[model samples]
Target: MNHFQDYTNNRSRLARIDASLFFAPTSCTPLENSVLWIAGCRPSSFIRFAYALSGLDIQFHLTDFLEGKRIGDLTTQQMTKFDELQGETIRKERNLCSRLASLQEDIVDQPFASKIFTSKNYEEEDHHYQFENADEALDEHSQHMAGVMEEADELRMKTLKQIVINILEPVQAVEYLAAAKRMRLCFQQWGKKRDHHHSNKLD
Candidate 1:
């Protein structure tokens, strides 16, 4: 496949999640921006993960703001604040993902390796070819990487607290938290399944 097709295919995946970052024009490729969306995973799964992390209402509308529609439920002040915090959370994640991208350089754009079930030897080796010397790079970027990940995590929590948790009734927040936890499991499983499919594709 041509480089252009690969880029379009990758960007289309992220756009589905509303998780797509300021892309292409950035120093990184589109696939680099979409590290959070593992190859072969459905965009809905990533969206579910994002929804859970943000603690937004089960039916929370992301495209509402993107489409320039005023959020019917939020006051003008509330909508503006939500946009600001939400934007901050997304930026932090994009920053962290980009920082972590280098550690994953070899994972994408490599020829697929066949899964050899005939012998268990492949298991002993890195079948996925991911994260080779990731630690060294992480150590090299340690200072910058550490702060970026921490800021991303903290900002997500802060935004979630302000826009969703703090505004919700105590009982509702508890229920939402429980549901989010369940959704997290689903997201993890979806990621694993996608990874397996990706492995096949590479082969």
Candidate 2:
């Protein structure tokens, strides 16, 4: 895969949960701008919580093995292992929704409340209201990030098509060509709608 496609694929997976953050509660601790909740063993399995964090204006930190100690810390082989663990966690969570009800309740209720109560500082030097307009700024920043991602997706598609042309083997080249064509159709159809929806939210 070309750089853009690979990046876009990864980014798309992350972006899928962008809407979940809407229901997340704000942080109560003034020093900590975000909270990291690790509900599953895999990175993707933690996506819902991540989105929840995003929606709340909190940065979601993945604690799965795949997430590791730092960004780019996991090798491809290690990530594959983490991915398997995450898959298992997701399956169990899906099947045992009732069993995990209390955990979910606590996450949504108590932790959220505490995070907000303790982190409500919006004061500025000389007693000014620095955060009075925070919500509006956040909305604008979200829109800007969404636009950047859209541009990245477009570039990814173009790069992938270029790679498809460079494949020398007839069979391999045909396969990539077909894949590239499908990606193009999917992007052309969904790209504008997605971008517009996100754009309108900032206004």
24-75: candidate 2 lDDT, tens digit per residue: 3242221121322221122232333322222321344423321222222333
86-149 per-residue lDDT for model 1 (tens digits): 5665665666667668535533423212222235424555664232334443344444334443
TM per prediction: 0.38, 0.25
- Cα RMSD (Å) between model 2 and the true structure? 17.8
lDDT of each: 0.44, 0.39
Best candidate according to lDDT: 1
Clashing pairs in 1: 112-202
**Model 1 misplaced stretches (Cα beyond 4 Å):** 1-81, 91-138, 192-203
Q: Give the local distance difference test score of model 2.
A: 0.39
